[model samples]
Target: MGVKAWLSKPLAAYVHKKQQHWIQHPVEAQKAIFDKIIRKAAGTKFGREHHFDKIKTHADFVKAVPVRDYEGLASYFELVQQGVKDVLWPGKPIYLAKTSGTTSGAKYIPITKDSIPNHINGAKNALLAYIHETGNAGFLDGKLIFLSGSPELEEVGGIPTGRLSGIVNHHVPGYLRTNQMPSYETNCIEDWEVKLDQIIEETIDENMTLISGIPPWVQMYFDKLIRQTGKPIKDIFPNYSLFVYGGVNFEPYRKRLRESMGRCIPSIETFPASEGFFAYQNEQQDKSLLLLLDTGIFYEFIPVDEYFNENPTRLTIGEVQIGVNYALIISSNAGLWAYSIGDTIRFTSIKPYKILVSGRIKHFISAFGEHVIGEEVEQAMDRTMAKYQSAELIEFTVAPYVSQDQGQSYHEWLVEFSRPPHDLGDFEKDLNMQMQQINTYYNDLITGNVLQNLKISVLPMGTFRSYMKSQGKLGGQNKVPRLSNDRQLADGLLAITSS
Candidate 1:
């Protein structure tokens, strides 16, 4: 073995063992993190405001800090933006992660010195865990491409501010920097399409081994590569062995991605956010991610069913159950206290605390009392697409559509298909059946005549891409929502298609 591979093997083993220690003693790890962060932040402005000093247990912590979304914490965040010290965490944050918000125009999440390690180390350990598990570290020698935001930062209150991925770009370790691809200049282009073309020009002939990005963006790169070279990605880069992705369910894009690459390869799914790194897939066979209990973040769970309750029941790691969807809340070293990031996750294993990203708390459809989630729709699409080998889906979204004339309602699936099935009617029927089987509420609505069978609106290829571009959300860390509760997105999509 080469020097890199030889050195990586022992390091991977050490990280793997360390990961197992936390995995074995999850409750203790979490409690330790909880105590450390709470005590550390007790002197900060938010800590004093919330009575963090008296918090002795989970119950006390819950009673002291109410669960809050970004809007709810706007006052504290505003203070931080005004160059205030000791506002949230002890002293000022090192960076601010500027993220696109829905109702709130833009959100600036703090990234303190202590909390930045969680984001960096979480990604590093995932790769090390993969190396340890698969006994394959050869990819470390070849070039790897991480499709991310620009590393360029703008100052906010004397602190650097940018997208989470962009902020992470500045922290790529020295060892990996040698193998990273797409020159720094190419990465800083503000226009995604221009950046993509430059990236293709820069690395089209290089020894590309691992490609990492959100699924859709990677798919875009692959498609453009094919168009430019008239060859599959496998032909262009034979050493490409691993795909690391997050931000969306991989199931829906699995078949298409495989076809683009001309074969299947190993993939790792991660659960990360601007809030903190929560989990990463440890087992190759299992798609579920192992929760990182020892990260600088303490987790809390509110059962999705009770999330809207005036006073929801808050549960710690010990109180959670497998398969129950919970709105993920966090109190982190970054000084976020009882903050709700709006994502929901379901535990798959309790022994090691494995989890699946079920959906977003705000991204669901319950128009007729049939609460269909992102996971359910994505699963239904996966199964339905699996039945048709000739079909290829680019992207899709689900929303409630009610006919004004007939007063009849149904779920509308706006699908952009690169290769449509031969029989549209049959595809629609199979998709509807799949949804009914997965979600009983949807089944009941259809059977009870409260709603009709879901309809598939065939959209041209690049429809969703064009829509995202028009909305100024074309690239890094942006994804089309799989499910929306209302028809706003549906109407907007149709309008774009028509124009």
Candidate 2:
């Protein structure tokens, strides 16, 4: 290890100890840390002018500063896009992590030195927790393949702009740096067709031990890997033990991964974003858990109902209850105060604060004047799968489209089947029936109760992956966005359905 990394190890250890202490402590201790972060954040220029100081209680802060989506950051986002110094943070940002926002088009999120520590700490804590749970740290000692976005940094108005994957790639630890398959700075977008080929050429012979990325990209990578190697991924990388992924639901993608890597490979989920690496899979690996990063951010949970109800209730880390979904609001050192990430999560436990990402708040299907959430769709799909006794789906994405002449509206499912069912018609019928049963509003839309023009259709297998790649979004971190309520959905459907 280099001198800097060696020095960082001790600091990382210290941070890890503090995080462990916070995790084991009562909610009050965690809240105290959050209060201190809020106060410190309020002291910043953006916080001061934005009214962060006027808010005393957590409730007051939630009330005073409305939760902001990506569009809310658009005006100042251009400043960061230009790589201007002191725009978002105190100094020149260390790097810019590029990610696609739901509405604001491509986003260049600033990552400062102050903010990076949180990402690092979050990753460390995730691994440490996994180690404690699995009793295995060496499981990842073999070659680690991270199916990340193109490492190429795009210059926006003369400033470097790229997704979080590129920015994080620029700063990978030198020891691990040599181990990365594709150097992070390469232009992944430019070489779309040969991207996977280049990755395979770089690491096909190496003793790969761990694979990480979004489920779809990982699945695609293995598909190519198998075709090239003339062997299953497990046969080539016998040492592979763990699959680490985040950014989308893995349930639809897990069956294929297990089949490709064999049933023995374990999977872990992480919740990292351009803003900050927020939470990760608990050590036990039972489900994705939210481990508080006390030093880096102060967090608040807005009850999900607050979106529709004017009198929105907010909760601190202490007040969250099990099985309730909440909108994640964060105030971080990176200049985002009470920011709503547009992602929704449900708590499975309060003691350790475990959560399952329900779906993106903005990804709901409401075209027919019916609010259909991702969770509802997910449950419906799960039920349909169980009822039919079909092989697990590799991945699926849904869009709300309307028929032109008929003026009819309906739900379209783009399903990737692991193994095709014998009776395709029966499967489709069962799926549609379960969906209508799960959500009365959805059923009403289909039955012409809500909107007379509703319909349902299924795209051929591999259509979702094709659509994701065509959008320059093929990678380990980005899944075929499960729900698309934007204009892009219309365009995507036109392109894929026509083809």
Candidate 3:
């Protein structure tokens, strides 16, 4: 057997066994993980402030540390910025994974000595799990390209700061470096467009077998490759059998990516947040990813239907039901105590726990009492575009139009279409209909003229990409918010397109 295969075989088997054990004893596994995290941070200020000394169970932990959003935990993180030891995590964090998705300005998530290995090992274990189940170990022998952030590390008050992907790239296994693409020097190039050009130039002749990236940016890269080479992606990477993706929904991009490849290559979805590496796709048959119960993270779920409630029920793995949309809360070694990651997810399985990210907690539109979320908008757009087959939704954002000049407040859908819909008016009608059918509040608003039918504005191509680039969040762990409560995205998109 090849050295790679021989090495991976035992690791794969171990992962398989561990996952099965997790399935059989999920409660035990999670409790163990939670306790371990508590012990690790027991001496930290956050832990002491929350009375971690006496916090015995999940309920105690919840009672001690109320659920927090990024803003809620901002004070503790501020202390970490000044190189405070044991403020959140163990010692001062080794790095901060910077983000701008939900909050304004920049949010720096702590990456401690304890949490760093979890991030790196999650990706490694995910690969081992995939290979164990599908016998795809040979991909490790060939070139694998992780279209990551600029490997150029920076400093924020003595702590290293960079994108999560870039931070993880520094810890990539020495052996895998032999087959990984985009040389470290090229990776250190900061400009995304310039970096893309170099990545294309470097990988043009490589024997690539695996690639990992978020959907939209990777799609942009693939489109550029096709445009340059005048060939499908399959022709470029004939053995590219694995595409590991996360940070965005893949369903809408899936059809487009598949069409470009001219063949179906298996994919693995992951739910890796900057706070922690939470979940990874383990099984092949199901779309949901298995929650990594053994990680140094404690998970609690509050039903999205009741998330805004004064006293929403928090359920552990032992109490959670399948198919319910739940907002996830995490307490981790990184010192985030019961922090809401903002993303909402639904469980597909209870035993061992498999979940698919459903939406974001904050990115919802409810201007006219027609509460619509990220998943709803994306699904409706995907379905509407699929009905015509000629149209493709590259990117979109929706906002409410409640201006006095615009009679009857309604939704304004700013969509960037790769191929213009066969009938733009009809496509808008179908999309509006889809939205109304799923959400009765929306349907009632339309019926009573409380809100007019949703409006559609065909955006100029490359508008979303341009906006992202301008915002300096063009690639790696960044995404465009689909549904905004205000006109931030809508106004910004309009300005970008017009200019």
RMSD of 1: 1.1
- How accurate locally, in lDDT, is each candidate? 0.92, 0.69, 0.85
Q: Is candidate 1 or candidate 3 better by TM-score?
A: 1
The parts of candidate 2 lying over 4 Å away from their true place are: 1-18, 41-44, 81-88, 152-160, 183-190, 308-311, 368-370, 387-392, 401-409, 443-456, 486-491
Model 3 poorest ten-residue lDDT run:
400-409
Q: Model 1, which residues run further than 4 Å from truth?
A: 404-407
- Candidate RMSDs in Å, in order, are 1.1, 4.0, 1.8
Candidate number with greatest lDDT:
1
Candidates 2 and 3 compared by TM-score, better number: 3
Clashing pairs for model 3 are: none
How well is each residue in 421-461 modelled by candidate 3, as lDDT tens digits?
Answer: 88899998999999998889989988887888999988999
Clashes found in each candidate (C-alpha, N, C closer than 3 A) = 0, 12, 0
Best by TM-score: 1
| Best of the two (1, 2) by lDDT | 1
